[model samples]
Target: MNSISSRTFWVSLAVAFGVTLYVTSSVLAPFLIGVAIAYMLDPLCERLDRIGVPRWAAAGAVLFGFFSTLTAVSYFLIPFVWGQLVDLVKHLPEIRTALMSYLQPALDAGKPHISPMVIERVQEIANISTGTIVSGANKIVKGAVTGGLAVMDVSVIFVLSPIVGFYLLKDWPELSSFITDSLPRAYEKKILALARAIDQTLAAWLRGQMVLCLVLACFYMVALTLSGLKFSLLIGLLTGLCAFIPFVGFAIGLTAALVAAAFSFDTWTGWACVGFIFAIGQMLESYVLTPRLIGQSVGLHEVWVMFALMAGGAVLGFTGVLLAVPTAAILRVLLKSAYGSYLESDYYTK
Candidate 1:
């Protein structure tokens, strides 16, 4: 094939493959998650192997350590989160009353002609109760019925992941060699350079973001609790995790904290303290945590990040959002390199 024909063929094939993957994404979710886990663990496994551990032994050790850590976190954190959610649900009525009391004056002052219908709708939504005990009991029963199947699925992935990861990691070098050897002779070097650049960018993003989330979560919990906020741990951990979704963490965390402050303490002093706590947290995150951990060089603007997240969510639900930023970053680097090459070419200069 001529260069143009070859490029067209490859692009068409890529589009077809992407469409096929999208169509089958639900079934592939577990495998995708497993691959991500494997990717993260591969480095640790390699380090162990370099220190004289056998590949199988290293993989086993890494998997065991991963599960053990997960179990410990679940044991401690799950209950705390669950309790907070339960309490929050239980207090919904009171919270609604407090919210109305807080907002009634503002609404009256801002819009004298506000319809009662609108106010009623808002009040109805706010008064929505989760009825924790009854709801919890029903959920438990439903969960028990569904849990068996979920467990089976988890077990299958758990079993398959390490095996797949082991072979993938073990054959990683050979796989790279095979791919490089098979590439078109003319494009081989350029393709390899692009691949390496994409890999490094993704690795930095995934690993760095994970560490940042943990650090932020710890900081949020300590700061909020010291400020005497209710459900500090739950709210903090949630906020940190949601930080992955751009501005979502700040919005949710601040809103929750503000409401809790409104309810828990009646004094303006209490409210001011809550506001100051979040302001301090934001400042620390901006000035210290993010800079120290992830740095500003991920090369994505906040607006672009938000757009990619929304686009991804629209296309592929949660998985798309998860994959979007790294994918965008990699594509951005490739495009920049390609554009630079074009700029240096005779056709572009002319």
Candidate 2:
């Protein structure tokens, strides 16, 4: 195909794929999740195979470790997190009361400087916002539980993901080779090179992000618990999970921790401790952990990543989010290659 035609064909194919994924999102979530899991674990499976383990055995081991970890989290951690959520919901009124008590004095002091109309409007808005927030929060929590249960009852994600992951991991080599073989002979080398680049980029990001999440979770959990914060475990784990989304995780975690501290601790010292804990965590992540673990040269920019995540979530919900990074990585590789080719062509050289 001519270059323009080729580009058009690929773009059309991508759009079609995206539309199909969106249409079948409800059913595709499990399969997509399984594919992601398998992709991440395939390297380890290959490593084990290299070290004389059978592919099936390696796949099984990975699955076993995964499920064992899941079991532990489900038994020990989930209950505590659930309790904290329920407690937070129950105490929303108290939280609002305390917040208002703290802010009211300032409002009163500024009354002389501020118009009575403005004060009344502010008060009215605050009350409305607080009511909406509390009611919405309560509804969201209940709806989340109901929605999760409904999904589990209807979808095969819980049951099928592991099975799919296991088979994909086991057959990874053959599957990969088949893809390569199916490619046009002239494009094989370039396509394979692009695939390798995409794999390397994704592997580094995903693996590093996972490690970062775990370490941050442990640090936050321990520090907050030691600092005597309420619901520290839940807040800490949640923050860690959010860390994958760049700034969003840190902002959410910090806000949650601060609110909890504001309610639980009577002294300024407790507040200071919470601040110190998060400050140190942020510094460590930005300066040490990320630089060393995630490396300095991930090709995708933060804005691009944030955009991809938002776009994915908007279009495909959870499945889009799962596929976002890899898709971004693939497109980056392809675009870079195309740009390089363009730079070398007569149009650019002239």
Candidate 3:
């Protein structure tokens, strides 16, 4: 129909999709995870199809191989990580005690600037916060009976996500064709251009982040384990995996690593070694890996990414958080296009 009506229809359609995501948030986790897997694997499947492999076989082979590797890694790594986690939980009191011993001087030094009540409350909390943290962690994992993630069932993610990914991968060509055919004829070129921009930005981010995560994980795991730290893999790998989130991931991972180091070592030399390792990680990520892999051309500033994630999490819960990056990237492209159009219009020239 008319431009105004078409715009209204698309906007309304977007809002409805968002509402549907929220309503089906529980189921959305596995489906979204599956969709993400499928999206990432689509390129490989396409390549296989072009090389004389049947599409169904290609999808099946890729899915099977990917999941097989994942399952194998999990099978071995999970037990070790779980064991470390158990030991770490058991020693939380000692870790807390050791932590407070180091921080007690800082707490005392802050007495003049900080209120006595606040300092006193902090010490009180420090005395028992470990148990609270452990309890909370326990509750979260206990919720795993449902089969997904926190609030969603954790176990279901393993079974459901891959299944969803497999089918999506198999039908991806048809899906892409359907979507392309449905675009409004008048605006199809513009829409396709926007889609391509978003695709490039998103693909760069997803692939780069995956590489960054793995590289960082390997670095941390090897370095920390070499230095004799406990749960090095869990800490390192998690830090690396979450590295896509910017500072928060590294900070959280570093904090845990430091705590574990503190508990594991007697001297400041050991702590210094651990600190050095992470410092190197931060420098490596900021200076080396990120620029080489993701680059600055994508317009994904750390601040914007963080803001999008936080806003998404606030507005739509976990599903929002999962979608935040791609959605923000798409919006960024659209906003850029809109701005260009606005600059070219008579309103700007007048």
Instruction: Give the TM-score of each candidate.
Output: 0.84, 0.92, 0.91
In candidate 1, what are the lDDT values of residues 197-248, reduced to their tens digit?
7777677767777887787788888888888888888788988887766677
Candidate 2 backbone collisions, by pair:
none
Q: Compared with the true structure, what per-residue lDDT tens digits does model 3 show for residues 277-315?
A: 999999999999999999988788898899999998998
User: TM-score of predicted model 1?
Assistant: 0.84
Q: What is the C-alpha RMSD of each candidate to the true structure, in Å?
A: 3.8, 2.2, 2.7
What 10-residue stretch in candidate 3 is worst by lDDT? 143-152
lDDT of candidate 2 over 261-283, digit per residue (tens): 87889988998999999899899
Supply every candidate's count of residue pairs whose N, Cα or C atoms clash at under 3 angstroms: 0, 0, 7
By TM-score, highest first, what's the ranking?
A: 2, 3, 1
Global lDDT for candidate 2? 0.87
Q: Alpha carbon lDDT of residue 140, candidate 3?
A: 49
Best by TM-score: 2
- After superposing candidate 3 on the true structure, give the runs of residues whose Cα lies further than 4 Å from its correct spot: 107-119, 128-131, 137-152
Quantify all predictions' global Cα lDDT against the true fold. 0.76, 0.87, 0.87
lDDT of 3 at 281: 93
Give the higher-TM-score candidate: 1 or 2.
Answer: 2
